[model samples]
Target: MDAFEEYLMTNLPEAPSFHPVFNEALQAMLLAGGKRFRPRLLLAVVDAYTPLLRESAYPVAMALEMFHTYSLVHDDLPVMDNADLRRGEPTLHKRYDEVTAVLVGDALNTHAFYLIANAPLHNDAKVALVQELAYSGGIGGMVLGQAIDCWFEGEKLTPEQVDFLHEYKTGRLIAASLKMGAIIAGLDEKMQRELFDFGLDVGLLFQIQDDIIDATESSETAGKTTGNDEDKNSYINHFGLEGSCERADALAARIGERLASFDAPLRRSLEALLKPYLARHKTK
Candidate 1:
């Protein structure tokens, strides 16, 4: 396991036997296998910019993972997608109860901020990181996106509307992952914005690929619910499978070009970080 996993295992919430199951539900949802992409992205950005800061980046990375896991837990709730599986295992709501899953999600969301506020970085950096996460995952970001998706189910959204939805719902946190790393590294505002834009492109690509996967793959293969997007406003709904695939490819190429434009070592490090995602576009 990675240091993040170690930290999670060691620091997971503990409770009395009367409510041990609550904490256990949180652990099960969190420790369920995931790609850890957001945290890895944060670490990679730190590594590319300042290797010495890698150690200091762990808490922030874990915070991102926690926030992401919280989102997944809530997304799979009966009130949302009503998913049965996540990461190839029963969803929190499925294994436990709806109320437990809801509380676990809430706990993870708040704990994510606690981790950020208590991270070893300077106070100013911590403040900025917290603001970014709140904006990305809060009412104007992920929540807004989800609300739009839920409200507009079965409605035919224009391409622009679809982009707006995904940008806030899925892209904001991904963008924040890179921007948070830049902030931790003390990079200038210009470089931070550049990285944020790069993250936006990557985020769009990821969502488009996700829509494709939902259409083409199965729940077992994806380790989560599939075919759920068919009734919602999604890239596949607006762009169709072939168009969505082409758009994902185009975005991947754009991101590759952007990475290549950076300085030699930074370029190489960023490319290495993105290799798996880029490879997915090609193989798909």
Candidate 2:
């Protein structure tokens, strides 16, 4: 595992792009990266069950990052989140024009499936992955979430409504990333169920952390625009700070207990994945 981590860090730069334009977009997104959480989660589940598939895992994981980057790019447009900062740099829309940002997002989104379909993977599995990515990113998942959120803007929403906003928008992709890795690793029904639950809990807690960060952190600390969600119905607003903390701890504990079925190394890494949320004891 240590050796693999070393390899991941060392070989990250070696994945060559086939064209200059493709490489340019990939490089810009990668250089202005934030957390690399989705790709890391993809690698984790694949490594848990099928370490031999790590080579394929890289392209698969890279596709997740690309797809995620596209979402962020479009999310920051004037029509969407209107974010000015991302990964501590000007957002694509801010650095470039809105048209370029839109194209950059479109390019990344399409290129993700492009990489997946052409990856050194079995045809059936590649098709399955492409389909999953499409559903998760399209009207069924992230887009649905965003639509709900945008529609609900300026309207009073219950906590359930807020959860609805995030479950599809944020949770869907995170859950898909987990399930996709499990699928690639050929996990059985039981493991898949466990992972799905764990991913949901992670996603739920993640949105909570996002809300807390918005209330507490400066844009500099968060590496993205802060205080954005406060304008929207938020966990912190619905549940007080103490209430949100309690919910976060309870969610983490439940998810942590699910790790009992996992191996020691995977459990350790999963714990690390939860740490940021757990230790996010206060706002900034």
Per-model C-alpha lDDT, please? Answer: 0.85, 0.76
Clashing pairs in 1: none
TM-score of every prediction relative to native:
0.95, 0.87
Evaluate residue 68 in candidate 2 and report its C-alpha lDDT on the 0 to 100 scale: 89
Expressed as tens digits, the lDDT of each residue in 98-176 for candidate 1 is 9999998999899889988988889999999999999888986888998998899888888889899999899988988
Model 1 quality (TM-score): 0.95
Q: Which of the numbered candidates is closest to the native, going by highest lDDT?
A: 1
Residue range 1-284, candidate 2, lDDT tens digits? 44434433444332354653444544565577567788788778877677889887777787888788889988888898899998888887777578778887887788788778877778877887888789977887899988887887777688888787777888878877887888788877677666766787788888877787788889999998988875576788889778887777787677767776678866876666656665535432
Return the TM-score for candidate 2, rounded to 2 decimals: 0.87
